[model samples]
Target: MKNKLKEIFYAGLIILVALTLGLAPVTQKEIFSLKWKNLGLQLVEAGVIDQEKFENLYTARGGLSESDKEMLYGRNNRDFKITPENSGMALHMLWAFGLANKNPILEDGPMMDPRYGGAENFASTGGWTLAKGSTMDHYSMHSFVTLTDDEQALVEKVSKGIFRPCCKNSTFFPDCNHGMAMLGLLELMASQGATEDEMNQKAQEVNSLWFPQVEKKSAGCAA
Candidate 1:
């Protein structure tokens, strides 16, 4: 009986190890890639992100790391990889891009719904204080990454399915920072000819990083 019990214990231990490995969270992998050549420079030049204010925000949060500085100020020809360490900066970068980029989603979509009292009233709009003027001044005002008609349709369709942990609304109705940042990401992906599956995959990866606490709870529950 003792030998039989030992065998069962070892078997259960092995099974537990395997399960733990299987459910390990993907926290360090490259979540998404952007051909981010001078896009950050463009945003600063357009005054959508005041360089001083932008830098100050990060300074208060332990200052921007050298890599973060490069992404925002340097003309990086290399594909920008989004990892957990820099996801916060990426969020703001994409938020600025999403907010400033002229797209029908911001101009004509649910953001403009008559019941919202105006697009400027939402956190996604009013919370962005880094702009040169009122956040509304840059709202959908720049043609940074213009999408073709078909591409725009893809963005619209995909945005409807993507929701942030901060809110229940889909990216189609970007009332908060996460939703707006995601909208920016989806637009960039679509403009670069990313397929629907690729967009969805990247979105999930990025969202996990953006909301790590929620992801941790989810992983724990699964394990």
Candidate 2:
């Protein structure tokens, strides 16, 4: 009976994960109604992206909703959604967020692993081309988001649970850009009061956007 129950539980868990990925169109539709204005200002203050540079880059891209403009300038709250059209930008934005957000994970965590030579040498830190200076200038040095002790603990816990397809390690060991970006997303969600379950759900959604092909295949098997 115990073995049977274990199998049943595993089956349910697989189905849930599969369905979540299978319904990507629906699950990925989640929109984050966070204060993106603050995030933008944080990015600028941290030198993650210069204001002039951001304007030039956005304009060159050629599509800006009035809402997008507000996210850049106004203090209004903003809604963010991940789609194929904008996933790359979202990754960059999240990368900046992860870099600037004040968290112990980046400072004393696996990012400091001696095997990587130094934190700044990794893709998460080194690959950031949009920064005004060396990416190390902002690496976990800015107080972009102030989390309470509880929130910090929550972010740390959730980050360990998330993994990106590009790396075998979890976000806690963010050696690559995707892992770091996911760490930033997890921090933002925790600071904004996302519960553990909500954080996990959002992580999966972001991961799906980042790796749709992989998500589709895994989702197909149990769906």
- TM-scores for all candidates: the values are 0.84, 0.76
Candidate 2 has an lDDT of: 0.74
**What CA RMSD would you report for each candidate?**
6.3, 11.6
Candidate 2 C-alpha lDDT tens digits along 114-153: 8879988888888877789787887888887788999989
Model 1 pairs in collision: none
lDDT of 1 by residue, 78-110 (tens): 787888888888999999999999999998999
Q: Model 1, 205: alpha-carbon shift in Å?
A: 0.8
- Global lDDT of model 1: 0.86
